[model samples]
Target: MAARAGIASSSTTLSPRVAQGGSNIRGEQRGKKRKSPCLSMPLFRSPLSRMLVSPRIQLPGIRLRSPLVGHRKSPYAERRMLHIDLNMEVEEENADAEERGLDSGIDQVHQENAQNCFDADDDVPVALEDEETGVDPGQENIQPWFDPFFDSDVDDVVPVPQENTRKNVVPDNDKRRAIFDAMLVKARKGYLKGHESKEVSAQFSVPVRTVQRIWKKGKSCLDQGIPVDVESGRSRCGRKKMVVDVSRLEDSSILSRTTIQDVATQLGVSTSKVYRMKKEGAIKRVSSSFDPHLTDQNKIDRLRWCLEMLDPRSVPHNPVFKPLFDYIFIDEKWFNITRKTVRYYVAPTAARCIRTIQNKNFIPKIMILTALARPRFDSDGNCTFDGKIGCFPFVTHTAAKRSSVNRPAGTIEMKPIESITKEVIRNVMIEKVLPAVRAKWPREDAGKPIYIQQDNARPHIAPDDRMFCEAAKQDGFNIKLVCQPANSPDLNVLDLGFFNSIQSIQYKSASTTTEELVAAVDRAFEDYPVRRSNKIFLSLHACMREIIEVLGGNSYDLPHIKKGVLERQGLLPLQLRCNAKSVNAAILSLRTMADT
Candidate 1:
C-alpha cells in the first residue's frame, strides 16, 4: 500500500486540481519524490501484475478511482469512481489444439496459454514471459477496433505497398485472352465499358495501353464474325532477324566453328549473342565426324547389292522390294555397362548418389551379337514369328585364378571376350547364332533357305566358314551368311534403325557389371516391339531406294511415311513398292558399267 501510494503521489504532474481528494501523506510523498530526485517505479507498477495481486483493491494508477481521472488523491477513493476502460484483445492460440485434446502454448505444443496484452494506445503486443530467449518481438499491427481511427498523423493518408511489375511488357496469349474475356463480359456490343481497360490493366499485370490494344484487336475480330482472338504478334514484334551472310562464314575453318565462342569471336560479338543466331537458324550446329570415303567400285557394288534384293517377279512394273522374312541381320555392338553420364530423377531430400568405376577409360563394356529377322504377321496382324533369334554376348565364364577384393579365388565369373577375333565370331555363330536361328525359324519355312546378313567387319567370318557350314548343315537349314556392301551400313536392317531403337531402351536401365549389361541388352532386344522391327525393315528398303536413286550414295535423308498412322489404319505395306523406271535404270546402269 505504501509503495502504491508513493508511485501514485509521484505522478502529481498527471493529476488535476478537480481531483484533489488526497491525504496529507500523499502530499508528503509527492514533495519527498520532488526533493529526492530519485523516484523509481514501484515493484508492482505493472498493470497486469497489479491487477492479479490486488484484485479487490482498485489501483488508481491503473484505473481512475473516480469517474474521471485526477478527481481523487487516494488510490482507493471511490467517489464518482471512474473506470478507465482499457482497449485490449485477448488471443488464445489453443482453440484448435483444445478441440483435438492437445495442449498448445507460446513456445511449446504441450500447454495452453492465453495472452492479454494488445495495447490500443501503442498498438503493440506485450509478451508476459520474463527474459527474451530469441522470441520475435510482436508486431504493432493496429487492431480492427482502432486501425481506421488510429492515425499517427492526421493529414497524411498511408499508401498500401504493391509488388513491382515492369512496365510495357507485351502480355502472353493466355493473359491477353483473359483480358479480352473480362472486357467481353462487360462490353456493350464490342466497345469496352468506359473504365474496363484500366480496371483490367490493374487486375492483370498488364499496361492499360496493351490492354486497350488487345480489346481493340478482339473487337476487330468480333466485327468480322471471327472468333475473338486477341493473340499479340509477340513473336513477330521482337528484335529484327539477324542477317547472317553464310557465305562469309564459308571460308571459316572447322576450328573456328567448333564452339560458339570461336564463331562469335570471328564475327566480333559476345558468345551470348551467338546463341540467338543459333536459335534463329542464322547459325547452325553441325557435328565433325568421319564417314568412310566411297570409291567408284564401292558405289557400283552397292548399286548391284540393291539390284539383287529386288523381287524378279515385279521387275517389269510396280517393282516391290523382296520380303526379307527369311533374311536375318546380325551385327556386333559394344554396350557400355554404364554410361559416363547417366541421368536420374531423385527427390530434393534424397542422398546424392556417387557412381564409382575402376577406370574411366576402361568402362566395362561387352560385345553383343544380335540376330533379328522380319516378323511374320498372319492375316489378322497377329505375329506368328516374333523374329528375335537371340542376342548372344561374347562372354566366357572362367574361375578366378587370383583372389581380389571383388571376388574370392576359384569363383566362377563372367568375363567379356575383350579381343573379339574371327574365331570368336565363328564360334558364336555355330554355337549360339545358328542354334537360335534353327529354333526360332518359322516352321512353315523350315525347308526354305535363311540368309544372315553381316557387315564387312574384320572380325566377321566368311560366308562358308568351315565350322558354321558344319553346324548349319546339321539342322537341315540352308542358312548362308552374306556380307553387306563395304562402307554401306544403311544396307543392313540392324544398322539402319534397329540397333539405335533398342540401344535407347537399353540405356534406360543402369548396369554395373558385364552380366548386367548383357542382361539389359537382351531385355531391350526382347522388349523391342515386332511392329517397330517391321518398320525398320521398311526403313532399310527405303535406304535401298535412296541408294539406287543417288547411284549408290548414302547422302539421302531417311524418308518418313508416318508408318504408325498407316499401321493403325491397316495400310502399312509388307514391302515398299519401287518405281519400275528407277529399278530398270539401276539395272541398266549396272549393266553399262559391267560392259565398261
Candidate 2:
C-alpha cells in the first residue's frame, strides 16, 4: 500500500495481496448495504477472483500487468480508463436487470463471463479483468462478422459501413437460394476466415446473424450426412392457392355459372379467389348467343341462300359478293319508352335518379320498321344519296275519347297499332316506305332492280304477293321483295348491329309515351351515319362468308376488318370479297344434302 505507482508490483506473477485481498474486501462489502440494481453485477470482478463485487466501488487509479495482451502498456492510468468503461456497462446492465426481473440467482447470470477473465490472468492483480472480459451491457448485435470492414489495399484503412442495419430486408426465394449457395461454397471450403457469413451478408445486404443462422442450419444437415440446403421450400412457405376443376363449368345448367358467386359456390372456392382466377385469365365471362338447332333441310336452305348471294360474274375467278347497293335491308323493331337501366351524372349531394310509370308492363312501346340502302358515293368520294329510306311507325292517328292530363277530349292522338297483321305491314310499306324510297333514291340508281330484302316473319308479305307486286311496280320502280332464311336474323344488317346501335342512342333519353318513343327511335334511325351503314353492309358480307364456312351454321363470331380505317383511307370497297373455296364448299354441301 505504501508503494508509489511505478513501485507497485508489475510482474506477471500473483502478488501476496491477490488471493487474500479480494476475500477481505468482500467480507467488508458484505457488511455494507447494496441497492437492488447491484444484484445484476458480477460477484467477483478481480483479474483473478471468480466472485462479483458491486461496480459502485470505484478504484480511481488501479493498474496491473498480465501475460495475455502483452502489447498494451502495463500502466495503472490506462487500466483506470478501462475500469470506468466497465462501471458504465454495469450500470446499464443494472438498468436492464430491473427491466428483465432477475428471478434467478445473480451468480447464475455471470459465472461463465467471470470465469473466462481469470483463466487468462490467474496471477494478475485485481484491476485488469474488464480489459479481457469485454463486458458490454445488453449488447444485442454482437456477433462474428458483424462489423464488416471492406479492406481494399494493404495500406488502405478498411471502411466500416452501416450496411446491414437497415430493417425490412425481405428477399424473395430466388435471392435467398443464391445466398445459400454462396454460403455452402464458403462453408465447404473450411470457413477459414470465420467471417464467411458476414462477407456473404455484405454481398447480399442481409443481417450478419441471419446469415450465421442460415449457415448453422446447413451445417447441421451436413453433420447428419444429408445434402446441405439452407434455402426454404420455395412455394411451400405461405397458405396454398386453391386449385379449380374446369369440368364444373361445362354443365348445361345455368346455376353452375350464372354469376361469380354461382361459379364459386359450384367450384367450392371463395368468391374473391374465383374473381382472382378470372383476373389472371384462368376463366372468362361470355354471353352465349347460341345457334338455332338446324335440321338438314334448314341447313340446305341457309347454304343455298348464302350461295345465291355471291355474284355470278366473280364466282369461279374471284367470288365476290353482290354490292347490295340496290338491296334495301328492312327490319321491324319494338322500341320501348325507356331503358331498364340508365346512367346520369348528378351532384354528389343529390339523391339517386328515380323514375315512375303507371304500370311497368303497360309502358309505352311501339313497333317501327326501318328501311336502309347502301349510300352511293361518286368517284370523288362525295355522297350522292344518304341511304336512309324511311323509318315508319305502325300507329294510326285517332281522336282521344276521354280527356287526360296530357290531352283534352277529341284531340287527335297517335296510338300504337294493336294487331300487326300482314295487311298492316303491306299498307305501311306501300303508303310510307315506297314513297320515301322514291323521294330519296339516287337518280342514277332509279329504275334498277332494287331488291327489298326482309326477314321471313309470319306477318311479312311474300316475294310474289300480288298486292305488294302491284304496289311496287306503280311508280316506274322495279322494287322486288326477297325473304331471307327463316330464323336467320344475322343475315340482315339491321339485326346484326344497326338496331342495337339505334337502341343504344334511343335509350339515352327518357320517352314515356308511344309518340315520344316513336319519335326517339325515328331520330336515332335518321341520325345514323351513312358511312357506318356501308360498314354494316361490309359486315353483312363478312357474316355471309362466315355462314358459308360454317355450312350455314351461325356458331361463328362476326368479323370486323377495321372498315372505318379503310373507308377513311378511301379504300372502302362497294362489296366484300368471299373465299372461292368457301363458295365451292357451300355448293358441295347443298349437293350432298340433295343426294341424301
Candidate 3:
C-alpha cells in the first residue's frame, strides 16, 4: 500500500509534467484508481493515501500567508530576528533569570527588545530622524522635517504668529545677593558681632549664621586699626548722658527744717526733686515742741464749769466749783462796772423850784431770785448786807443811793435803794423772784432739795420770804436759802459776759427816768448778738467743768439762785416762775419807756 501511495503521488506530478504540468500530479497514472463521483469517500484513511487521493489539494497555485510568515526574508525582518536572538542570548546570560531556568521564547524576546528600543528613543522626536536624510551630527543647518511647513515659498499651512512680549521676571537672586553683601559690609565694620549679628540678621534679611560667619572673619581686621564705617557708627544721641540741676536743691534749703517731701508739696515739685535736694545738703530736719500740760484738769475744769454755769441742769458738778477760783484769778478790770456818764442840765428856775434836769444813766436792774439748801442768807448769817442802803450779795452795786426826800411822793418807792421789809420782800419774792427762778429751773427738785443762794438782807430772808419758801416746799419743791459770799462777782460767768454786755449798751444810751431806763435795758438785752450768747454759754460750760474737777468728778449741790443767775446770763434757762403781776408791771415799765 505504501508503494502504491508513493507511485500515485508520483503519477499526479507526471500528468502535470506531460503538459508542462510536471509540477502537478495525477491520481490515475500512479495506479491509484479514480473513484466514481457516485461512490462514498473513505473515512480515516492512511496519511499518504489521503495526500495522494485528496482531490481538493491544489498544486503550485498557493500564495505566501503573510510577509512575516513567508520563507522569503527582508532586511527589516532579518534585523528584527537578529535583535530577538541577541535579547535571548542576553536573557540567558542574566544570572538571576538563568538560576530560575526559565527558557524564554523568541517572540517574547523580540517584544522585550522592541519595548527597550522604544524607551531609549522616547525623548528623541520621531520626526527628527525623518528630517535627518543624511545629515552628520556636526551639521547645524540641517532643517527639521517640519521646516517645509514653515517656509514662505512653499504652499504651507502656517498658524498665525503671536507677538512675543517681555514678561515681568522677579530679581529674587539679585535681592538675596544684595542683602548678603550689606550684612557682610556691616560685619567688616565691626558693627555686627555675637548679639549684634542676630540684630543684623533681622535688619538685613540674612541668616544669623551667615552674619556670624562674616563677623568672626572680619573682627580681627576691625580691631587692627580699621576704622568703622560712618554708616555703622553708634548714634550720637544714644550715648549722651543725662544732667541733673543742683540749683533747684539750693533753693529748697531756705525753708526752715522742711523735709524734701514737705518742700516738694509746698513748691508743687516732685518728691524726687526734694530727695535730690536733701542729698545735696540743701535742707535740714527740725523736731516739734508742743506742750501737753496746757490741757490740765484745773484749766479744763474751769472751762467746763463756765460752760455749765450757763445750763446747770446739764453741767457736771466738778466744774461748777472751778468758776470760783477762775473768777478770783480774773483781772479786776474785768469786774469793775463803769457807770454811764450823765449829761446834767440846769433847767430855768421856773418849773416848781430851781431845778436841775436829772440826766440819769439808765441801767435796768435784773431781779435775780435764788434758793439754797439752808437759811444761811438770813439775818443770822455771816454774809450780811445793809439791804436798805448797801448792795446785797449777788447784786451789782452799780446804782447810787438817794435821800427819802428826793423820792417821788405818793409813788410806790420800789426803788433799788429801798431797805428790805417783810411785806416788800414777800411781794418781790412771790411776785418777781420765785417766778423767774421757776422759769429757769422748770423741774422742781423732786428727789434732792435745791437751795436758794442770797446775801444776808432783810428782803432775802424776811418773814414773808420765809413763808414763801415754806409754801414752795409744800408744792413738791425742797427749797432752802443760802448765804452767798459778800461782794463776789467773779463767780458768775454770765454776769461778766452777758449782763455786763447788756448794761454797757444800755448805759451808753442813758435815760432820764426809771421807765426810760427799763426800756433801754430791755432793748439792749434784746439786741444782744447771737455770738455773745454763744460765748456766755461756752464760759458757763468751762466754769462747770472746773467745779466738777474741784468736787472730784461728782455732782454739785449748789444754790438754785446761783444756777438761775448763771442761766439768765447765758440765756439758757427758759423756765421761770414769777408772779404775773410783777412780770406785767415790768413789761409795762419797759413798754412805757420804749414809748417815751
Candidate 4:
C-alpha cells in the first residue's frame, strides 16, 4: 500500500486461483535457487518496484548479481541492453571528467560553450578541460597570459612601417641607428595599453612569447623612468683566438726559416698570420744580388783603390773629394737583338705576338764599347759639353757569301763580330775611343791628365801597351790608362748604372737583326739624357763613399740625390762631397791590411 500527497493506493488480497498459480511458479524456482523475500513480492509489485526489478547496468568498480535465467528469454531484454549501453556512456563521461580535473559543473560549462556564439572580439577557448579541477588536460601548472580582447583606446595606433625601420637599421654607431631605435621604441610602446603582447607581436612581426618578455623588460624600465632600449646582442660573444708572439720573428730560431709557410709551421700559426706580419712591416722583402766573390787580397786592392780617390790635401780637415772631371769611363757590353721575354698590352680581341729566336742565350748581339766623361756645366748650370764621347759597335762589313731573300750575293752587309779578342779591344780604343775623346775633349782640358778607367777584362790591353801609349801621346794630351780594382764593377762609371739605362731604352724597340741591334744600342747611348750621365758621375762618388763605409764590400743601395733640382738651382757640383768619416774609415781599413 502507498499513501502520498499525489497518490492513493488500496491493496486487495488476490483470489485463491491466481495466488495459487504464482505460488506454484515461485515454488518451482525455489526448488532450484535460494528463496528470497524480494522474489516472493513479484505478485504485489508496484510500478517503481517493477522498474527496480528490471536489469540494472554494471559500472566500473561495482558488483551485480546475474538475473534469473527465465528473464534471458523475456521480451524486455532488448530494452535492458539499451539501458546498459547508456549507463556505460555516462560512466565513461564521469571518468573523463575526473581525468581532466573538472568539477560537477563541467557539464554545464560544456553546454554553455557549445550554445554560446563568439563575437568578433571574444576570447576563443583553445582546448577542453577537466570538470572537477577546472584545468585543461595535460596543462596542470602553466598559467600563460591570455589577453584576447587587448582592451585599449589606442587600438588605432599605427605601427611603424617595416620599410622605414629596416632602412635605418645599420650597425650601432651609424647615424641611422637613431631612427631605427626610435621606430622600435614607438612600435613596442604602442602595446603599453594593457600590456597587449600579442598585438605588439603581430605589429612588429615577432613571436608572441618574445613580445611578452620584451614588454615585461620595457615596463620595468618605464617604472624606473629610464628610456626603453633593445640590445642587439651580448658584446664580444665571438670565437676566441690564440694570439702568437710576433717578436720571435727576429729570433735566430725563426730567422733560420726562409719561407713564410715554413716559419708559420714552426710557430704553429697560419700562413696568413705570417703574411700579416710581413704586411705590418715586421719583416722585409729584398732581392740579394751578391757581390763578386773576392779574396782577401782583392779586398785590400779594392780598399787601396778607394783610398786613392780621396783628396789627401783635404784629409785631417773638412775632407773634399776630387772632381775627376777628366776621367773617361769605358766598358764593353753585348746588346741583344731582342729580349727573351717581353710583356705587352693589346686589345682584348687582338692576336698575341708570336716571336721566335733560334736560341735565347745565343740571340743576335754585338759588343758595344761605350765611353763617357764627367759632364761639364757652366756657372749658370748650362751644359757646356755632355760626357757622351761615342758608343761604337764591334761590327764589320763583309760580302754575303751566298744569296738569300734579304740580300743578294756579294752584297756588303754590316754584321756583328762574335769573338772580340784583345786585338779588337785595342783597335777600338786606339781608333774609335781615342779619336772621339780627342775630338770631344773640352778645349780647356786639352792638356790635362785624362785617365781612361777600364775594368779588368782579359780582352782589355794593358795600360802600358805601346799602341795605347803612342795613341795617348798625340794631340799634346797627357791621357793615361788605369785599371779599376779586379772584380769591382761598382768602381766603373759605365758599369755602375749607365749600361743598364742604355739597355732599358734599347729594349723598348723590337730589333730582329744584329745590325738593327747595333743601331738601336747606338741610338740608346745617344738618347741617354746628359743630365743622367752627370747623375751617374755623382753616383760613382757616392759608390766610392759606400765602399769606404763597408770596408770595400759592395753591399749598399745606390744613394739618390735630386740632381735635376740641384742643377736647376745652379747648385749641382761636379763632384759629390764625400763623408769624412767614410774617408777615415777607408784609410783605417787599408792600414790594417795584412802584409801577405
Clash list (residue pairs), candidate 4: 100-130, 101-132, 101-133, 102-130, 102-131, 102-132, 102-133, 103-131, 103-132
lDDT per residue as tens, model 3, 292-365: 23233433333332333332442232112121211111111111122543444567773442324335343334
- Model 1, 1-596: lDDT tens digits are 43332223212222221222322324442333222211222233233532333212112222224322233243522122222223321122133324433222212311111123354578576443312111122422211111211122423534343346365687789888998898888887656665877898889967888888888888889789988878877678768966656566678888777888788877877787788888978888877556678988898999999888889888868788998988999998888876787777999999988988778899878888889888888998889999999999989999999999989999999998879898888888888888888788877787888888999999899987887777787757787889989998888888778888888898988787777888899999999988988888888888888889887876777788888999999899889888788888888888898788
Worst 10 residues of 4 by lDDT: 1-10
Which has the better lDDT: candidate 1, or candidate 3?
1
Better by TM-score, candidate 4 or 3: 4
Q: In candidate 3, which residue ranges exceed 4 Å CA deviation?
A: 1-417, 420-427, 439-451, 455-459, 462-468, 484-487, 525-534, 540-596
Taken over the whole model, the C-alpha lDDT of each candidate is 0.70, 0.69, 0.38, 0.65
Q: Deviation in angstroms for 88 in model 4?
A: 58
What's the number of clashes in each of the models?
A: 8, 6, 66, 9
Model 2 C-alpha lDDT per residue in residues 1-596, reported as the tens digit of each score: 22322221122232112221222222443224321111112223232221222233212123333234333332322332112233344446445545544323233323433443234646432223332333233322222111011111223434234343459666676777688778877765545255877789999988877677776776688779997666656557688876888677787486568898988888889999888999999999888756668777777788788888899999876999988778898999988887656678899899997787777777678888999888877888778887888888899999999999988999998899978999999999888888888888877767888899998889998899898888888668889999888778888889988999999989876786777788788888888887777788888889888989999887788876888888788787888888888788788877988998
Candidate structures ordered by lDDT, highest first: 1, 2, 4, 3
Which sequence of candidate numbers ranks them by TM-score, best first? Answer: 2, 1, 4, 3
Q: Which residue pairs does candidate 1 place in steric collision?
A: 19-70, 19-71, 66-81, 66-82, 67-80, 67-81, 67-82, 104-111
Which numbered prediction scores highest in lDDT against the true structure?
1
State in Å the error of residue 272, model 3: 50
